[model samples]
Target: MREFPQISYAFAYGSGVFPQTDGSASRPAMSPHPNPPEAILKWQKGGGKMIDFIFATKFTQHFHSLNLNRHRDHYSFLGSFGSSIISHVQDDWGAGAYFNPYITVNGTLIKYGVVNFKTLLRDLSDWDTLYLAGRLHKPVKILTEDPNIRVANQRNLLAAVRCSLLLLPPTFTERQLYTTIASLSYQGDPRMSLGSENPNKVTNIITHQIRNFRMLYHDLIMSLPNVDYGEARALQQGWMEDLKLDRPMAQDMDPAFRGNMVRRLPKSFRQKLYFLYQRKFGISGREFEGMLEASADEDAKGGLKKPVGGPFDRRVAAETDLREMVLKCVNQTVKWPSATQSLKSALTAGPSRTLRYLKEKREKGRENALCDGTIVALLGDEGNESMDSSENTTEDG
Candidate 1:
């Protein structure tokens, strides 16, 4: 859209994408972080920090080559070597994204990660790394999408709803639901352990960017078979739902729910979980697959045909097993590989900078990872509300 290369999908995220807080039509209000520090508020006015983006391109190597030809100076000495090395490391070792940090594109400091369009879809549907999945769970601006790709991604949004409802308690607030959804990809993430960001990071994202969270998930929330919004519109203060979790009805429905979630996972991931499900509870992959296909057939008959229909069924033993396996699979697959990518990252970062980069993560993690204050406040009371953009969103969003 901005004369960028052939991108199938792209988004601008973080404070950089946020509009100025002038509350005018052209400039939207800031996200609701009740008591943000002064620096954050200042940054909302328009910060000079590196803007972040996730780019799903037509071809990783071609894009990289084009980018290299145009902005040769953006990369470090090694980036000039070839695009092949970077593409291999991106797909084979690390999580799918191949990030080039601290590149100045036309005087604006930009950081972007490139991934194959196919890989992006898989991660969204299957929670492959939950790297992009996790990021997508929060608010982001969608720049472009192919028609079929946009339709396929609806399942990803549905999966997020189902997963969130499964883990949520019977009675919870809107913020609570989003917070749980936010925490899904972080369950076994090594970054959380290292204190790379705030333990309150997910909650903060929900509270601050409450409008985006609401706009994205509202349709999914309403689409649930067993919840009612009563009087509240999609995005409003004091919104709640009535969830009826009758245990017997829930148990009958568990198989369908389990099947849906398990089947949506990546093949290798699903296979591993399938074996474990059989070992623990004696349910074969075919049985699970059967339920998923049957359930899908229901969407046409006013959505997901079968029912013990509660917003979702109760969490069952198999669901718990699948959740554990997904965490283990994603964490193991991405953790060390990301570290390896970090090592290669030093190619772009000189000796002093590389050391500073490593040190900053470790030191900052140590400082913020264990903060006790943010923990207690999460469940206590509602904080003050902040501004949010109220424009209606479309699939293109």
Candidate 2:
């Protein structure tokens, strides 16, 4: 094992304390202030310690918008001075000792090492200039001027530092760390202070932090053991599956209708449909259904019997309202003397399209029947004739 540094500092600030219990009164109760720099220094001198420098709460029992793990905790980083010194600078600037830092730990990286923060800051300053274009929020100078402000600012910084430590890697340079923390830190309301009003500056700061975080976390992930990767992947997959089920399909049609249309379809047909949709409309399941429904409706109203002409067009019609139209044609053919040949011809044209056309015809027939009872009576007559023929044949036999 590599020789780890003996003296290491970690920051804790904001609502950085644990709730006071009867048994742990002297053990350091939770405080509204961020973690104190002195406390962080002491913890570093003592040994490995897990401290909260930032304020976090369990707001909900489940994750809402994103498919984040519900059981996993969510945190909010607050910038405060005492906590900032501990978490960010690793020591009070006033302190005489030169605190050379090495590592940071937050959510992912447990124990990792890095160069110093100053060098990282220099590199990140350049990065900020290029990408941020002076939009990034600079640290407030007023906090440094007043003793009271310094303490308060330090506490907030500590909270931000605490979050960074938990989430960042040890090898991250100061610039990387600073950028990340600054991004995570909340810029005060502009109305409250003139300095806070720059939206572009605030956005730049947040963007830098986010970018730094992505870099650091990605490194941390790569450093983890293969087993951890497998576990994370499985967890992510499970979450995605849950989302897929919970989230409604875009189309408004009943689940039964969708199932009836495609559930038992052959693999070849399914693949063909999937590709055809992806190529033509660049859409998926429910969207494709909606498009088909709309297209069929338009075709019906426009009186365009073959709006989408081709094998696929026929298939589309068969799968939608057009099925009724094709069915009506089949019924009409069946009423004729050469029913068998006509039915064969219709089927040969394409069973799917034939089905859709029949479906459309049925709808139209219903509408016509509603307008003129004569059409209904004629349909009834056809039914009666078929029944009478069957009865006559049965009696003669």
Candidate 3:
């Protein structure tokens, strides 16, 4: 007889293999096997873990026979549904096979596990990078449940990187991968919880990578046949115009003034200015102020006077000061390296004035509408109807 590995443990094959058993010995076998004891002995001597649960035994056989290989590097064998083979083997079989429970390494199940693990690690990593990289809380659950479903760390990281690239176009690069990991590691450290230490290393890395990618792939990105460089240029020009306006306003006004102005300014104006400065000129707040002062001087010298017969009537000094500062900054920071006046004029011309006009017009219209509505409400319906009838008749005649 060939000596098989010693079975320190035994797994009873359930009804799936043979007959059902009641607790009592007198109970008839649902399906009796001629050599039940022999079969058990054979499995025992072969170093198999004793599977007591019938469901477990059936599942294990079914899964094992199916030999499902769902993912690249992982396979799943069913051995007792929801049963732990390692524990059973260790308890029943003396140090037999490695007794290790191995899940499919890169299949759906493993991917799910990896995703879950990544999420767990993310909270343990740098959260600022996650946020700045445009990753929110949703992917965490998906990743936690499946990491190995795709490629190993490669696919998981790539997917996250792609998402970051797509949502926040300004800060996506290959270098971000290493930087993000490093940042996570640093922030996750328990030592530097307070003080002057910057926790934004991950953000910095991401920024650097984006810069590098832009520089390296400039031609390729620009060369894409379907790409609309014209639209992009227009967008760039629009942003330049905005930065030209804001840099000065932000510079000339004190924080209190800025806060007040910000509150007073319409949302559209504020957003436009922010995008222009941030995207086009990349002018710092300090630089923006310097530009404002220069513009103010120019305006005082009668170089760029306020337009005649305009609501240039209200807060002329404040608005003039604001515009001058912004134009000055744009002139200084966004001028072509060749110092071309045409480029400067193009950036500072019609659009800026148009933006101001539209904003003022809208505000005035809103105020007028509110005042008219209040007056009408105070007047009786008869008066309101009379006013409407007169307007309608005037139009009809």
RMSD of each: 10.0, 36.6, 32.9
Clash statistics: count for each candidate: 4, 60, 31
- Top candidate (TM-score): 1
Please give, for residues 1-397, the per-residue lDDT of candidate 2 as tens digits.
0122221111221111111111212333322224434434333332222222211111211111121222112211111222223233211121111121111332111112121233223212222111110111232111002233223223233333333333343244334444545443232212213221233433333332333223223333333221022233423434422311222111213223233333122222223343444454456777666654543413555673432233344344234433233223222322331223224323222455445535533543332111100000111243324323321001111
| Model 1 accuracy (lDDT, Cα) | 0.54
Q: Estimate each model's TM-score.
A: 0.68, 0.15, 0.16
Report the C-alpha lDDT of model 3 over 1-397, residue by residue, as the tens digit.
0011111111111111111121122321221223334433332232221121100111332232233222212222322322354223312221111111122211100111011123223321222122111222111111011223212222223323222222222223334333433332233222224221234434433332333222222333333222222233423434422312211100222233233332222222223333344344566777655644432313665684432211111222234244443333223322222123222222222345334433533443332111100011111343234333321001111
Model 2 RMSD in angstroms? 36.6
Ranking by TM-score: 1, 3, 2
lDDT of 3 at 105: 18
Error of 2 at 270 (Å): 52
Worst 10 residues of 3 by lDDT: 106-115
Worst 10-residue stretch by lDDT in candidate 1?
Answer: 371-380
